[model samples]
Target: MIALPFAKSGSQSFLRGDRVHLRAPVGGDYKAWAALRAESRAFLTPWEPLWNEDDLERGAFRLRIRRYQEEAQSGTGYPFFVFRNSDSRLLGGITLGNIRRGVAQCGQIGYWCGVPFAGQGYMTEAIGLVIPFAFEQLRLHRLEAACIPHNKRSTRLLEKAGFQREGLLRSYLKINGLWQDHLLYSLIENDRRSTTNNKGAR
Candidate 1:
């Protein structure tokens, strides 16, 4: 596993495009991240796993900090917060998790966007940057993403980022306290190469 401190050092680094920026989460960001969740509870709850009432408590921020730190250290995950470059507003977050180094050579993608920022293509850009990092920096061979079938937005984002629809998974995830069906998507290294080649051809 990569050293945690080494990973944490990357939090200060960022990826930038004309409209979006992706960077590691900072301690000061807890307030904003938590507030977005608090305000978007209703908009997001139905699509998310059960959240403890205490999940947003001020003191709980420490736990999140620790979790992020551990994730960085172990290389099991890299969590990033998305921002709009124009105004530096936090739009949402995406994570590359469950990273396995050996034969698996894969990781899963997960994300959430604030209700107000739902349709601006920020998440898609974030995923685009992260997937390359997963493949190039992390040396992962494949990446997987799953979304509730009802989440057409997420499905679209995955597709736009070059993931192929793999299939449906029944009772695959627990959302808002209920086991639900999900659609899986994946991208292999070859798929990325093909995409780049196709873009060049066009």
Candidate 2:
């Protein structure tokens, strides 16, 4: 059986490399999250789904928190807020959603990092930390990720994190008020062994 690490209290938390860390989002984060997301609006909108008018509202945040709590209780999703380890500044978020257990044991991964933190390795490091947690701890057998074709930064980050390009998914996602074509990527547990062996040699 695969060894798995379960989150304590809420979804499990971890430091992403020495530079970044991830923890559950709290009520206090609503302000910081809203500000950063606002600043990065133009930068993020193209690849992200259309935001609801009430998205940043305190009531919306409360509802979101409740939903995340229930999802955590049911083992359906794990959401985490990313931060800079040195200052604990909110950078963005990562989530393992659409989880399926049983023989498949799979989930889909999604993420976003604030504009100021973009182009740095923060997102990549966050993904690296989370994928292992999903595979080793959550006992998820396969992981899937999708990115808009024009999202070069996101595609590159996923590649760096060891996900393989699987196929093109026509109109696979709705973003910025329109349907968008996406490239799908996947990583399976079997690939982990070869990857581990290669890393051991380096």
Q: What TM-score fits each model?
A: 0.92, 0.91
Give one digit per residue, the lDDT tens place, for model 1 in 1-202.
Answer: 6542322422544667678887777767778889898888898888899998789876687787778778888889988788888887888888888888888999999999999988888788888888888888888999999999988888888888999998999999889999999999999998998989999998
The model with the greatest TM-score is: 1
Please report the TM-score between candidate 2 and the true structure.
0.91
User: All models: lDDT?
Assistant: 0.83, 0.84
The regions of model 1 sitting more than 4 angstroms off are: 2-12
The number of clashing residue pairs in each candidate reads 1, 2
Q: Please identify model 2 stretches exceeding 4 Å from their true place.
A: 1-16
Q: Which lDDT value does model 1 have at 130?
A: 87
